[model samples]
Structures are given as structure tokens and as C-alpha cells.
Target: MGANLILVANDEVASDPLQQKLMKATAESSGAEIRFFSLEKTIQIIGRAADRQKIFIVVKTPKDVKVLVDGGVPIDEINVGNMHFAPGKKELTKKVYVDQSDKDDLHYLKTKGINVYIQDVPGDHKTEINF
Candidate 1:
């Protein structure tokens, strides 16, 4: 059987320390690898997959990244979000930030029936927005 691919959302880091610790320990024990990265970092790692047994532990929300889907990795498991399908909708726009100007994420969401609006600002490498 192939190795497992695990994705842990960032929100779980502080609230689910025990589970995070256990996953880390287990991956280390099995000589498998565990990577804890932001959504961006996780996507970067996914690009490096080359048939190795890999597990990605993302302590962040799930967003669209080319590497996650296009990378050869099966992306067998992704653990994110709360019990609610749309958690903290009202507060999300305030809490999340767009770290880079790249709109791959925006495109991904739009394709999935989500709406996103972007405003151009001068000299803004990372566009800052309330949402």
C-alpha cells in the first residue's frame, strides 16, 4: 500500500496541540516525513514529491494551490475547517490575508462557485485587504 498523505489546517495548531504532537511523533517514528507549513509552504513541498512516502501537515485553512492538485502526490487526505461547512463566515474576511499578489487562489475559488474581488494598489507587493 502507498503511504498516507495528511493535511492539517493551521487553525488546528493551537487548539489541537495534542493531535498535532501525536501526528508529528507518529510520522517521525515510522521514518516517514511530516511537513508543517503555511498554505504556501505546503504547496511548495507538494511540488517536490517524487514517489516518496510523504505527509503534509498544514496548520492552515485549505485554499487552491497548483502544487496540491497538480503535484504527483495523490492528495489522499486533507483535514481542515470546523464542523460547520462554512466556519466563521462573517469573521473570515477580517481574519484571512492574501500574502501574495498571485491570483491562482482567487481563480481556484471562482471556479468553484465562489466570488472574489481584488483592487489594485500602488507599490503593493502583497495586496492588503480586510478580507
Candidate 2:
């Protein structure tokens, strides 16, 4: 996979030392530029990278994706990443969890012709999800 640039969620590089180190190595080796931006700025960044290949946006929850789609980010297929367990959340995959609200967000995405799936990380088995 050719990674040209990586846009990390704001302040994450400092808070997540391990991830920061990993991404730093990746950036150094792959010549990928890493920019830290707020969630609110994702749409603008994505808009600029629209013509680029293999753009990946990672968010904390399903609602974030719903917000992006609602705000007009044209996401067609989204793979749910590691969602830590919480009381009202249902486990879709061992690493992925969702509450009813999360399910509603997914359903909304599906209604918009956006495919959804479960894949906690790269190289993991991907499972298509339908509501």
C-alpha cells in the first residue's frame, strides 16, 4: 500500500505515544506527510484530497462517520475499527461494539448507499454488515 500522507486526529500524536511513534516510523519510511487536525476540519482536508487515491478517514465512533456523511464527505464504504466495550453497546466483532444509536447511524449510512463492514485493523478478516 502506497501511503502518501496521513492526517491524524488532533492532539492524538501527543496523547497516544505508541501510535505516534508507529506513525512517525511509517511516515519516515514511506515519505508520508503527517498533519494533525481537528475532527471539524476533516471535511475540508478530505475535500482537498478528493482526487487522491486510497484516502482513509478514521473516527472514534459511528456517529462521527454519520456526521461526516451528513456534512457531505461522500463515504461509500466504512469499516468499523476497534470500538471499546461499554454498557449499552453490542459486540459486532470481538473488537467492535455499538449501541442502538450507533446502529441507527449505520442504518442511516446504509440508506445513503454506503456499505458497512467490521474490520478492526488492516489484514483482518472483513465482514459485511447489514441492518
Candidate 3:
């Protein structure tokens, strides 16, 4: 997306002090303006940034995309990478994991006209995701 701003929207960092520290460290090392914000504030930030920046939002779940689109962010596509394994979740690829909620969220996004795909990294083969 040629994004100039990297917004990390994972709420898990709020509770995990180590994760927050690591995130900050990553930003410092990469020299990227990585902002930690909730999805609600993310919308306002994006609106304010639209005219002056390109944003790449990093989120943990498909629900995050749904929330952004529902709240009026123009997200037309999503590329999923590695995901943590959770109880009751099935592994789709070595890196992709999903539970029923994830499935439903992805289906919802698909119905809303978003192109969903799984590719762990750029230049890797992308598998088109279908509900």
C-alpha cells in the first residue's frame, strides 16, 4: 500500500507490558511511526490522516477490519499473515489459524466486498480465502 504510517491496533498490547515495550522497541529500530491506538480512535486518526498520509493498519483479527469498514474506513482488501494458535481454532496453513468467530468475521468482510488473502510475506504465494 506504500503506507507512510504504521498503526498497530492490537489491544493485547494494553495489558501486556512486555508486548508494549517490544512494540516500542520495534518502532525505534525500524524508524517507523508506529502508533498504538484502539479501533475507535483509529478511525478518527485515519480521517485526519487521509489527506496527508497513507496508512497501513496492523490488526489481530478480521473483526478489526469489519469495525474499521463499518465505521467508514475505506478498506478494500486485507492480507493475513501469521496468527497465534488458540483453543478451538483450526490451522488453515502453517501460519494461519482460525476459529468459528474468525470464520464469521471473514465471511462478513467478504460479503462486504473485501478481497481477502493469506500470504505470510511479500513475494510469497498468496492463497485466496473463501468462506
Give the per-residue lDDT digits (tens) of candidate 3, residues 4-72.
Answer: 667887667545778767877876755567677777877766767756777777888888888988989
For residues 16-129, write the lDDT of model 2, one tens digit per residue: 778777867866765667765556687666777745656556566788787788778777788877888999888887888888898899888888998899876678777987
What lDDT does model 1 reach?
A: 0.43
Per-model TM-score on C-alpha atoms: 0.34, 0.74, 0.86
| Clash totals for all candidate models | 5, 0, 0
Q: What's the lDDT for residue 101 in model 2? A: 92
Q: Ranking under TM-score, best-scoring first? A: 3, 2, 1
The number of residue pairs in model 1 that clash at the backbone is 5
Q: Residue 17 of model 3: what lDDT?
A: 73
- Choose the strongest candidate by TM-score: 3
TM-score: model 1 vs. ground truth:
0.34
Model 2 is weakest, by summed lDDT over 10 consecutive residues, at: 5-14
Q: How accurate is candidate 3 locally (lDDT)?
A: 0.80
Ranking by lDDT: 3, 2, 1
Return the lDDT, model 1, position 118.
27
> Model 2 residue 96 lDDT?
80
